[model samples]
Target: MEVGEMEMRMSTLSGEQGKEKETQSDEDRGYDENMSDSPRESVDSTNETPSKKTQLEDGSHSLSVIKKAVVVLTRLPEYKVSTLRPPTPQQFYSEDESHSSSDSDMQWEPEDNSSDSDFSVTDSKQKTGKPTQNDTKKTPAPQTMSEPAPIIISSAFAYCANEITKVRPDLPEEEVKVGMMVLARKRHMRWQQGKIVEIITRKDGRLKYKVNFVEKGKSLVSGHHIAFDNTPKLEQLYVGARVVVKCQDDKFQSAILAELPTRKNRLRFLVFLDNHVPVYVGLPLLHLVCRPLENSLDDIRDSPHKCFMSRYLRDWPYPHLTQYSAGQSLNAELNGVQQRCEVQEVDSSLIHVVFQDNQHKEWIHRGSIRLEHMTRFLELKEIEDYLDDSD
Candidate 1:
């Protein structure tokens, strides 16, 4: 029992020693803190004791005000603050900065008469370090294309008065002028060259022209069947006139003008051949005689209608192709990409289509969409039944 009491007394002594050591360490920390504050206190005493400092010393400063000052807090390691110092005296009057003052930093003093005092703060972009719009380079204006020269002919020129014009299929009336020359196409005959002497417009905008065909005589016809005469550049393209036409490989070959340019085709000519049978060629394969001499023979054939059908369909856009009507389903180009569309309307300049993707209607130009090139692979009644089946 005596040995157990001695062991308890030893434990009590060790506990007392630990308590003494902790108290000694706390006193030492207080002493070190006082030592660190000594220099600051001396400096504060040397300077004028400001109202803020005196309020802090008295512990009368509010928590919000103390938090905002943050002079001691900024010196902490958490903020990584090294310097909170003001600019040095030498930095304000540096030799290099004083000698080379930039326009951006130019300041006017009361002693300076060179600069005005009414400085603007609105355009101080340099001070704020923001970009200015004036620094960007301006884009140059686009160059315009030159206008086409006017098509003029002397009044003495006889054939220039009534030139041919093509009747646009989209419009009800042919927009033909009184003096414009148009090709008067008959049922199975060669397209007779005619000049519009007078145009009589009906109430519904249908044009009836008194066409004076130089050979077939004067006849009043609707402008629907007439086409503009854009024949090959020839001096005088008569049906039986002997002409030296430009052939393949830039060689001039002898030929006769069979027919002038139609809407479907250009000028067609009967080219003479030495060995093979004479074949009719168009303007691209043959140019009209630029200069013909006195001995120009008048070439004519009894079988002129034999090869006229073959030559006419050579450059036809809808050859073996089906014509598309309204409510017809077809794939067509929308913008630039081809998509499925239903034909809503067809006009000379534009074709209205309803796109399947967006169910939106858009007008496509006649030049872009090939509505004429559809071939009839199946029966027309079968196609109608197929469309019904799809529905």
Candidate 2:
């Protein structure tokens, strides 16, 4: 019975010692029971190391709070950013401006973007339960954009490359018309690219063609714009064509096209006075014959001073000249009666004719001789020969 009494006393002493240790722990925590309602900072014990002398050998004391610690949040990458702001619920189809404009005018509360889970709004704050003062850092917005490649068109159509080959035949027939722009060869002025639109006939046997030039977002220009020209064209000056003869004054009368400068060569061409008579003149010297139009005024022929002739042929300085050969027989205007004559020599300015009836030699001016309208041009020749001709 005495041994049993001693065991009970030992049990009571052990219970009292456990109560004293718990009281000492509560005092060391520095948390009062009444102050439990106030905010309490959480301590991070992750980086704590065991001390050399283990005070927690019995596991009765608490560790001191860490002085410094870093907090990081692992969040999903926002690789697909639809907009700069937080994503909210949006309807795929929207009303017209009438209804949409009125909706924008009304006062509305800010939307709770988090409630809309359709679009996964990845936020760092959501990834981490709540940001503490130690790790309250911001993340950079994502870089996103979708755009198409640029397609720039300077012009709709460029000049025809065939001018050198199809038009000149002197150049290769390779595709060079692309990107090339056709401009007026007129001097002292710049010309835009022109597009041939139509062709109209004149009182004469010449057919007038129309050309158009469209500026960048400007006005429209037609063949009748007065700026358009028919000369230096691609057709009448082609390999072979018949024409009437006339006289013109030019400084290149002596210098050949092959010897002249590049600028002057462009203004030169070959003209046949007759089958045997060949002459070279500046391009401006020759006039392409005009075809009679359906509404042509034939009455203007009788009266040389008519308005149409005056307006069109105002620049015609030389009178029509006729072609003659050395042996051909013809009539002369020396006497009132018709006299039979024999051709002696043919010159550009003068023609020598001898009267067969009287045996009298006379030199007649080119303007005095009457000739037909048949004028011939060189059919074919090596472009190199034409360009390199010295005589």
RMSD of each: 29.1, 33.4
Task: Name the lDDT value of residue 148 in candidate 2.
Answer: 17
TM-score of 1: 0.21
Q: CA lDDT, every prediction? A: 0.40, 0.34
lDDT of 2 by residue, 1-391 (tens): 9679757866765676577557655644543443444233344546532222112323455333333342222222345223334654445433221132211111111122122211111221123232233332232122331221111111101122321111222432222122223232121212333444555566875444444444532222212122212344443343222223334431111111111112312434544332123354555544332221222223123232233123222212212233456787655654545577777997543468788877988665333322111110011112323655855
Q: Model 1 — which ten-residue stretch has the worst lDDT?
A: 149-158
* Positional deviation of residue 198's Cα in model 2 after best superposition, in angstroms: 20
Candidate 2 lDDT: 0.34
In terms of TM-score, the best-performing candidate is 1
What are the clashing pairs of model 2?
Answer: 160-177, 161-176, 161-177, 204-290, 204-291, 205-290, 205-291, 206-290, 206-291
lDDT of 1 at 323: 33
Overlapping backbone residue pairs in candidate 2 total: 9
Report how far off residue 112 is in candidate 2 (Å).
Answer: 99
Ten contiguous residues with the weakest lDDT in model 2: 372-381
Q: How many residue pairs clash in each candidate?
A: 10, 9
Per-residue lDDT of candidate 1, residues 134-246 (tens digit): 42112112244122111111111113212221111122322567887766544322345678899787999866778788677777775434555544444344443333444
What value does the lDDT take at residue 258 in candidate 1? Answer: 34
